[model samples]
Target chain A: MILINGQPENRIPVSDRGLQYGDGLFETLAFRNGELELLEQHIMRLQRGCKRINLSFQHVDSLRAELAMLCAQTAEDSVIKIILTRGSGGRGYKAPLENEAIRIISSHSMPEYPEANQSGVTVRLCEQRLGLNPTLAGLKHLNRLEQVLARSEWDDRTISEGLMLNINENLIEGTMSNLFIVKNQQLLTPALTQAGIAGIMRSKVMEIADSMSIACHEKALTVNDLLDADEVFLTNSIIKLWPVKTLLHNDTNTHWQHGALTQQIQNALKDLAH
Target chain B: MILINGQPENRIPVSDRGLQYGDGLFETLAFRNGELELLEQHIMRLQRGCKRINLSFQHVDSLRAELAMLCAQTAEDSVIKIILTRGSGGRGYKAPLENEAIRIISSHSMPEYPEANQSGVTVRLCEQRLGLNPTLAGLKHLNRLEQVLARSEWDDRTISEGLMLNINENLIEGTMSNLFIVKNQQLLTPALTQAGIAGIMRSKVMEIADSMSIACHEKALTVNDLLDADEVFLTNSIIKLWPVKTLLHNDTNTHWQHGALTQQIQNALKDLAH
Candidate 1:
């Protein structure tokens, strides 16, 4: 089902800035057993994105209500996507002074992954590099050609995800998830001060680590650091966590055991989900 | 009037990747006195952009026919915009194997600029900076949040445009146009190898300079380079060329005469338009 500005429609005007210049923000959420997971965190992130882009999105309560309404009708686990655009009709890049935000909420069946993926999945390094823009860092905006190009680098069904690095050669994130590495029993994730998205599931994992007294840090990470790590994992709202069993970099095939910390975090996340 | 894939419609599917991830490219063109200006140049640039992004735009002939049809019905000078998107229905960032391109062609009334703007216009330095990524540079793709943010920095009607620099503080281009500096009777425009859109008019200006035997080079430019220039101007498809009379930067204003070379190029462009 799709709701465009509270209406049952599947079409938007051709002039929408979201379509014209990708002037919008989006959130991918999980709905499990008729409940939206991480609803508040998703809303908080969306709100921050709107503020960063100066898009006036004034439908928070109504959007929440609509999500609840949609979830109640779904019988299976689903993925909900919400798109908020700086509404239509502007001369060019300069936005309309009096603007109303356009909200699109849609739901789709959750992707069915192989059962083995839960244990561990293979990941590859993408050739496409992300551009460094601090102003847009950490915001899940609609301008995502970099991710799309990176994701297009491979079509191997066995490789679950592709990781991307910024132009500076620092490992930043996966095409659809945040990356984390465990080294000497310490958790480290790339700081998104220059690029990459600050995913909701990534934040949740960090919080869970803090509660368990695990040392977690956000800093610049390199391929060398990732290759030397004790364990590695990827996270997103849909796929909560996927342990990296093997990494394909250039012609290399480094392997890991999916270690103790990854298992602990996975179990903690599952417990919270229930 | 508007046309979506040869149909006279103003709405597109909400699932369009153009809106979802900005997986698209667009071109802004000018139609004057029932004739399209630089039609081939615009189409060539769009084709190049489509190739770079791997979007199979297989409707060049039909697109030309539609633009000619749209221009035939217009009785006044107009601006035409064409947007080609990588159709719909993709899972996450990975594109669908079999895809069709979505084309949107629309016509708008020409913007009314002050007559004095032809003589010279004021420009300001934008605080927003563009990110550097060679993979996406020079292609007029749909990821334009950086330009949108830069244009939003000022609302002064008198300021004709804003100049943007990349993260490295290298002067790249104007918010809505390409920039060129004249020094020692030579022409210099910032190289778009690392960032900035390679505007169609920028290419035309370079060609015009070459025909006139004026030395022209594309190189990294700084604010000091701009201020030290003998003359400065901006170019785009809509506003053919506007000599920079005043440059507002960091609480100081630098002034310039329209310069003889600028007038000579303007006359040459006018002759070609006729």
Candidate 2:
């Protein structure tokens, strides 16, 4: 099902700035058993994104009401996507002085991943490096061509995700998820000050780790550092966590066995879900 | 007027990857007196963009036929825009194994610029810097949030355009046009290896210079070099040439009296248009 500005429609004007210039922001969230998981966090991030891009978002209360109603109507697990565009405009990049925002909310069935993904998945490094822009970093805005291009780099079903590096050759993130590596019983994830989206699940996982008294660090990471880690995993709104078993680069590959830390984090995530 | 896949429609499916991830490319061209100016160059650049990003463009002949018909129907000057998207798909970054491309073509009336713009226009330096990515650079892809953001930086009516620099602080291009500076009777534009779109008009100006026996260079340029130049101008498909009368940067304003070279080039462009 889809809704354009609270009405049932699956089409937007071609002149929409979202379609024309990718001038928009979006959030994907999961709902389970008549409740949205991490809805507040998603809303907070969306509001932050709107503020960063200077897009006025004044209908937050009504938007929440619509989302809650949509969640209540869903009978099973589903993923809900919310898109806010700068609305339709005449030609050129200069926006209209009085442009109204467009809101699109849609729902989709939950994806069924292979059982192996729950245990551990294989991954590879992508050749396309993300462009570094501090102004746009850490926000889940609609300008995501780099991720789309990186995801299209491979079609092998065995490989689950591809890791992306920044222009400076520092590890940034996965195509659709945030990356975390465990070394010497410490958790470290790449700092997204220059590039990459800061996933909501990543923050939740860090909170879980804190409750368990685990040390977590957000710092610059390199491919070699990721390869040398004892354990690795990925996180996103849909797939809360996925242990990574192999890392492939060109003709060479590095293998790893799922460690205690990975199992413990998975257990904590599951327990928190209930 | 608008056409989607040769059919008249102004709306596209919300599921389009172009709206979702900006997985697309676009071109804006001008048509005058029942003829599309630089149509072949636009087609060439569109093809190059699709090839660079691995989007199959098999219907180039048919696309040309449609464009010619659209241009022939125009009674006066007009601006036509062509967009190619990866089509609609299920949720996620992974494109469907077999994706059908979507083509959107639209037309609008030509904009009326002030007579002063022909003599010279004033511009300001934008504080926002472009991100560096070689793979995506030089291609007029749909990931244009940076341009939109830079354009929104100011709302001054007198400033025709804003100049942007890359992360390395080297001058790249204007928000909607390419930049060229003249020094010692020689022309130099920024090298776009690291960032910036390689504008078709920029290439044409260089060709015009070559025919007129003028020196043209594509090299790294700085803001100081731009302010110190004897003359500067901006170019795009529309607004063939606009001389730089004044450049505003911080507290330092550089004023220039329109030079002979600018007039010579403008006359050359007008003659070629005939």
Index of the highest-DockQ prediction: 1
Candidate 2: segments with Cα more than 4 A from true spot: A271-274, B271-274
Model 2, range B1-274, lDDT digits (tens) per residue? 8878888899999999999999999998888756677888988999999888878788888788778777766788999999999999844888876675688988888988899998899999998889888889999999898998898888888889999999889999999999999899999999999889999889899999999999999999999899789999999988889999899888777888788988888887773332
Question: In candidate 1, how many Å is residue A121 off?
Answer: 0.4
What clash pairs does model 2 have?
none
Q: Write the per-residue lDDT of candidate 1 for residues B190-269, one digit (tens) a residue.
A: 99988899998899899999999999999999999999999999999899999999999888999999999999888777
lDDT of 1 by residue, A17-132 (tens): 99989999999999986678888999999889988999887778989888877777788999999999987877799988767678899999899998888789999999999999
User: For each of the candidates, what fraction of the native contacts does it recover?
Assistant: 0.90, 0.87
Interface DockQ of each model: 0.91, 0.88
Error of 2 at B100 (Å): 3.9
Residue-level lDDT tens digits of model 2 in A1-274: 8878778789999999999999999998888666688888988998999888878788888788778777767889999999998998744888766665678898899888897898899999998899999889999989898998899899898999999999899999999999999999999999999999999999998998999999999999999899899999999988889999999887888987788998899888773332
lDDT values for all models: 0.91, 0.88
Compute the DockQ of candidate 2: 0.88
